[model samples]
Target: MTSVPRRTLNEAVTRFWSLAAPAYDFSALQRWAYRPPQDEVITLLRDHKCRRIVDVACGTGILADRIQRELKTEQVYGVDMSDGMLRQAMARSGDVQWLRAPAEKLPFDDGALDAVVTTSAFHFFDQAAALREFRRVLEPGGIAAVATLAPHQPPLLSRFIDSSRSLAHNPAPDEMRALFTDAGFEVADQHRVRRPLWTRMFTDRITVGVRSA
Candidate 1:
């Protein structure tokens, strides 16, 4: 079977989100399905006391906006590959420096941020390259919190699920921790999180790692 070209796959994802940006915030998936995981990410970042933070693949800037409000800091930034998404994000907040950039290539300087976060979108990233960039842009001892889907049980079934998506890949929980470790971060915490009384439609494994100091 022929594989989809990398560029083609990326462009498709961008186009899809660009079109989805207009009503993304109002989507049930965003309002209901993903709320629990997003909340968990917010709590983790707050607990770490991150003052300077960036949210990657921050569609419509919902999470970034919340972070800015929670931290009461003006150093928050939101980045997404979709221009349409950034436009929507810009309307949401003036404090966050909204930028259009891919996960593998951030606009921040080395050791510039206290925390790097990307929730509900890690499966769409080139995990290795993105993690490396996350580490590169974070100060030593900074936190990297990534919340996303993971492959389910049964080794062969997990492999099948990952292979089913040509443009997206969901790593197993252990594999995600290993990826963070390989990217020069110390695996700090890794677990599945869900809001109480919420449907299990989108439970995500959140992995927190600290850049080696």
Candidate 2:
């Protein structure tokens, strides 16, 4: 597979989300489709006792703010490529240190984070590079959690979605697990999740991995 130029991908994604940032939190897609998995990812992070965590592609800082409050830590950070998104995120929490950065090039020291989580935005990432960055920043035994769109059922539909102009790649749960493994993480869990209403056409999944100590 050919790699997208990092600069081009960053520019395109940043432009798109920057324009959408103003109304992102109010969108039905955010409230209905993305919220459930975000809640789940938060629970997982809390369960694992992750106090120093960063939320990647953290649009409007919703998940990162929640993580900060729930975990009661000042170590929460939010990273996104869109300036508009970071601006909105900054308003959500004074505690969360919001940074404008891409998923593949996080601006942090290696092994500086206890956990890394990205929800509803992984499909827009260069999967391998993002995962490697996740692993690189996480301390040993730190967790990496991802929640993203599931591959459409019926191989044809999945292929169609992959080939769409959206520039997203929805991997099956197994493929996601494999990605974690290939990125040097120990695959800890994998499961499917769906929205309350559209349990069929739109689906999501969670994959958790642990860096070795």
Candidate 3:
């Protein structure tokens, strides 16, 4: 996946989201697996005193809604590569600005945002590019809080999940922490958490990186 088929991949992603849009918020299992971690991640952002923020790859703006309602963040923007996803997001949270854009190319100016947050979408990103873009948009002392599936579990479980994963990579907590440090954010926190889907448990990581003040 070194040389990603950008156009082809983008089309596929868009098509997938478009189909998923109608029932995205209504799915019980999807909400169970993703929403719990989202609550914790939003708490992490607020604890860092993040004022202005962008939720990159913000699918349906669920986190954006929470950022506004919980953090009372002055300016919250949501960015995603798929228009269909953004459309659903815009509909759900009309006040927040929803942009259909890739994470590797954000619209914000250098050092323009106080914090950049993303969830469930990191592994699908071009890692270096996306991290660079994150660093580029963050202000000094800014934070980037990412919540995603962690590659940690029983060996057989990890192998099977990795094989079925659609993204380029699913990094362990250490790998993600180092990636943040390398991208100019000073690593502040990294830990694993779990969300349950009825009988199954899903492991995840919440990694926070802060730019030097």
Q: Write the per-residue lDDT of candidate 3 for residues 104-164, one digit (tens) a residue.
A: 8999999999889888888778777888899899888888888877765556546644555
RMSD of each: 3.2, 2.5, 2.7
lDDT measured at residue 58 in model 2 versus the true structure, 0 to 100 = 93
Candidate 1, which segments miss by more than 4 Å at Cα? 1-3, 153-165
Of the two candidates 1 and 3, the one with more favorable lDDT, higher being better, is: 1
CA shift at 21, candidate 1, in angstroms?
A: 1.2
Better of 1 and 3 by TM-score: 1
lDDT values of the candidates?
Answer: 0.85, 0.85, 0.79
Sorted by lDDT (best first), the order is: 2, 1, 3
lDDT of 2 by residue, 1-213 (tens): 236666776688789899999889886767786788888888898789888899999999989988888779779999998999999999899999998888999999999998999997887888999999999999999999998877774565567456655466788888898899999999998887645765445667889999976
Per-prediction tally of clashes:
0, 0, 0
TM-score of every candidate = 0.90, 0.90, 0.88
Candidate 1 at residue 152, lDDT? Answer: 61
lDDT of 3: 0.79
